[model samples]
Target: MSEISQAGGTLGAGDRNRSLTYIFGLMLLVGFGSPAAGLVDVPITFFLKNKLHLPAHEVANFRLVAAIPLYVGFLFGFARDRWDILGRKDRGMMMVFASVCAAAYAGFAFVPVSYPMLMAAVALSAVAWSFARAAEQGLASMAGQQLAVTGWMSVIWSMAASVPYLGAYLIGGALSQALEGRTAEQAARTLFLVAAGVMGAMALYSAWKPKFLYSHLKAEAHADRPLQDLARLFRHWPVYPALAVWFLWSFAPGSGTALQFHMQNTLHASDTQWGAWNAIFAAAFIPTYLVYGALCRRFTARTLLFWGTAVGIPQMVPLYFIHSVDQAMWAAAVIGLTGGVASAAYIDLLMRSAPKALQGTIMMTAGSLYWVAIRFGDVLGTRLYEQAGGFGACVIAITVVYALIVPVLLTVPRSLIATREGEVLPLEEPALEVGAQETLHA
Candidate 1:
């Protein structure tokens, strides 16, 4: 018997404490990183819309810059996995990313805020965020195993991300109102500095708490060739269907600038009203987060997707008819309830399929899939809104595209699906026998 099994009933005093600390370390990096994203986004949006007087399309252009770096998530994953650290790999990178994030934000504080300047600053910040995010997600995946509850990991991450959205809406709206003229610039500068300070603190904590914070990496020592390792994944059948899910579900043809313009121009919402709608949408995620957490433990990935996607895609229908701000808020709240469920389910399934050795690569690549879909959706949504029948027309097209997720979901093999009934780790051969039926010789 393993010593662990022999000593199962009791833990040493130090061992017990260290294990507890380890749990916290796994969650801390992502928790902080998720909320920080809200801080960056809300301020940036208000800066462009209220200060610079740019249209929704222009704002989306800025978002494009912020999004582009995320497409290379595999690179970040490769770097994290390939490098050896003096301490621990994930912890070392967390500290480095936090420092870089701080520096980037600090630089943003001094730069002149113009179209080009805003794009550059936001893009730099996005790169920093990408690294920090990759590190946190890696830690989160490890933490899930330690906690013996993967569902809660998704819940915590989603909830943590939501908190900032809610706060940024209420607080950011207030900041917009209070900080006028020169103060608007000053407010942005202050927010940037605050972000820098927070990241600096994160670095300091990771450095000091390496004993607690470092991840217990379970990946094999090294691969002979990185490209071949990746190529092997591409040859795997499940990856294609999973990517299709992201692309189809997120391929909303009438969102991005279209939806924004609808809310601002058509609904005629003020800044605070617009912000309130967002805050309410985020607030609705609380209950859904809890419910999804429980559901993940009880249900299979395919089942989760069927029910989740069914309910979630239709939620957009309300947006088509939303002529008033009240209607808009209600729509957001309704979508929030189901949207959270669908999103968490998607994440749960993806993680279940992640290769043990390439956990970082698979997870980050999954993230990249989501963003790539969003970017394409944004471009399509904008053009559709302009070319089609404005908001309603675009919504209709998006709804149809979203429904196509059902067909895409069907294409994924049952062998690839993960559940409480069975796990689907990426290294496992789901392609033959278990993944595919054995063919008898004729």
Candidate 2:
């Protein structure tokens, strides 16, 4: 046997680059498939606000219901980690669930329009999507760790998520307007049909099986002991810090539904203008995300974490100053820029801390926490917007939550402090696994 490269040596640098590129493309597809993205979200929100004539609090409640499935996302991740999906592992999971999601969307499209039905349909779709997300993130994290490109992988993931906002917001906004003359049932059919089409494309791509993904699938270990893996994941100290970061960072009380209502009620912003704001904000993240990709190659996670959180602490401050829609639009770009580096760095930390065998469970749990935080934040934000000092109160609350993350940085293990180009320091804890790395290196 020959020596395996330190980063699993199965693939050379060029090959790793190619694989990362492929994964980026897959993430893009998955991002569009996500219900939170503009493709599904804009239409749903418009339908609720314009057609059903629901208030902000009611809209938030519906959102909470639709996202209920995502809050238990770890169970889906556990399923992915433990099962082989007819012996095809991640690939099979992606294909099957993407199809299921497409079918769910189609079901929603044809069904009679009712709030309960819409919420139930979206929640069911969320369940299928949770599985697909588990596979997608699990594969990306595992491959990035094996290839020692976690930072670039983080960049790829964030960019894949953010890039869609640019065009999708505009398109979704326009699409919402286009459906104005149609009845609720007709609009439901039109919007969800478009969503079904995106998921259908996702299923097809999974079937195509890109080379890097196929190779990674071939190299993965088949036998999965969930209890043992779960124990090990809990015992791992590095994971806690990453989870804390994700939860705190995502728990912004000033954003999402609260912010939307503020723009509508206070600033008198129209739906199309709101979409333009999102588009501008998302576009601003691209350059900063790219910058962080370069910065991650040089700095350790600790260094980046400190500075990133510092930048994040003041991110919500811009919202405090926005008194008009035009000011809000400019502030959106500022807010996006402030959090871009921090968001990418957080994902880098997450990918770095994940145990090799239990990547899916860990990633999904983190994702679950994100949904939990966002939902609860929405609840709090709505109350604050109504009873408290309005949007300014929410902004202050968000800034304070962001500030709490700086202390969490201290909890990260010393091993993960290394830069992406370097090796993780040896830990005194139990080994994650010997098989996957050993096989890839072999």
**TM agreement with the true structure for every prediction:** 0.84, 0.93
Best candidate per lDDT, number?
A: 2
- Residue lDDT tens for model 1, 75-100: 77766655545445566777788889
lDDT of 2 by residue, 1-442 (tens): 1111542335656666777788887788777777765378777888899888998888888888788888998898888777667456677888899899999989889889998888887788888888988988888887777666778888899899887777678777777788898888987888788888888887787666555434433244423566777777778888898999999999988587889889888899887888888888888888889989888767776788789889989998998988899898889889899888999999988888887667888889998999899988998999999899799999999999999998888888766776544344343332443444223421
- Please give the lDDT score for candidate 1: 0.64
In model 2, which residue pairs have backbone atoms overlapping below 3 Å?
none
User: What is the alpha-carbon lDDT of model 2 when measured against the actual structure?
Assistant: 0.79
Clashes of 2: 0
Runs with alpha carbons beyond 4 Å of true place in candidate 1: 1-37, 142-148, 208-219, 421-442
Model 2 residue 5 CA deviation (Å) reads 2.8
